[model samples]
Target: MVDWIIFLPACFALNMACGPSNLLAMTHGAKCGVPFAQKAAIARLIVFVPMIAASALGLGLLLTASPFVFGIAKAIGAAYLIWLGIALWRSAKTLKSEEFLDKSVSMKIAFRTEALLAISNPKAILTFAAFFPQFVILDAYWQSYAMLGAAFLIMEAIAIFAYALGGSVASTFAADKIPVFQRISGAMMCVFGTLLLMAS
Candidate 1:
């Protein structure tokens, strides 16, 4: 029941801030030069699914609860979104130096980094809980919830993939222009943060 298209951008933005994905991409950009696609896919696989499941469960519980609890959850979720937006905005301006980029980072390191990032991201958890049930009709069968869940998973998968690919391609062309890339990526993060605040 949720507008899958509308939810895609929010999901993408939330995932973009994911520490592992961003760190891996930044590390690769700085050192071994792995394609963004590879990094993104790994990030998505390791991080997204578990978060999505956790979110679905949390959201489902909230939706099934009383109106008061639901309202409290919404408020908490909104405030968290605002905080996340600010944090991301600040991160936009801080670029890792080439020296930092030159360090060797293993896939295992990348996976652990992403896992921690995903686990600690309260915004991601609340967003999934708050936004997912909007499409579910209470009177409808349980199948409605299942459908929405599947739709969200698919949308998030595609959006994260595209973002990673784009980042990889853009990073390649901007390889000679690291400063520019950093600035642009930073600005984009700020913009995403702003959007999240506005949406909340």
Candidate 2:
């Protein structure tokens, strides 16, 4: 269990840290609410943990062995992120700027959007590929990493929930409430996409 003690904090801190994922959650929660954030959180976790586990189990090795495949994935992910950014920016333009959030985004769209946000993040792939191995018990196979993965996901959900709650509170006092969330989300996606392209 020492691995759990050592790794869980690192995982929590890593997840809670400033990143595009948290940025999206905070900004989005501010615009929507707790339910929106929760949906996004759960959807993101469903996609996020599996991908990390895949990498931890064997996909990371595959990527290492096949640079060409990784390159292709990197390119596709980068492009998708930018595409989402453009879509978000366009949506922002469609909606009227209002001080109060008069519009409600459905859970399905929110879930899908958040899932895409989590999946498109190449940094998560790279992070797990690098960090997850450090704590693995060689003989334990999947069990060690599985424990870590569960802890990471739980911590991640809590961190996002906290961020969302804080963001919602901050939103009320925001001077430029209108367009704040959309603009931030759109901008972050574009920035993340560019970063991913650069890293690729």
Best by lDDT: 2
* Per-residue C-alpha lDDT of model 1 across residues 1-200, encoded as one tens digit per residue: 55567665765565555533353355344334545335534664556566656655565355435566545544544454344435434543554545324544566655554554444444555655676667566776356556665655565555555555555555556555554555544454445444543442
Please, what is the whole-model Cα lDDT of each candidate in the order they appear?
0.51, 0.75
- Model 1 CA deviation exceeding 4 Å by range: 1-36, 39-46, 59-104, 139-142, 179-200
lDDT for position 180 in model 2: 55
Instruction: Report RMSD for candidate 2.
Output: 2.3
User: lDDT per residue, candidate 2, 1-107, as tens digits?
Assistant: 33777787788889888676777677667778766787777888999778877887688668756878777777877887888777777777656545336537667
lDDT over C-alpha atoms for residue 27 of model 2: 63
RMSD of each: 6.7, 2.3
lDDT at 70, model 2: 77
Model 1 residue 8 distance off true place after TM-score fit, in angstroms: 6.6
lDDT of 2: 0.75
In the predicted model 1, the residue pairs found to clash are 30-101
Show pairs that collide, candidate 2.
Answer: none
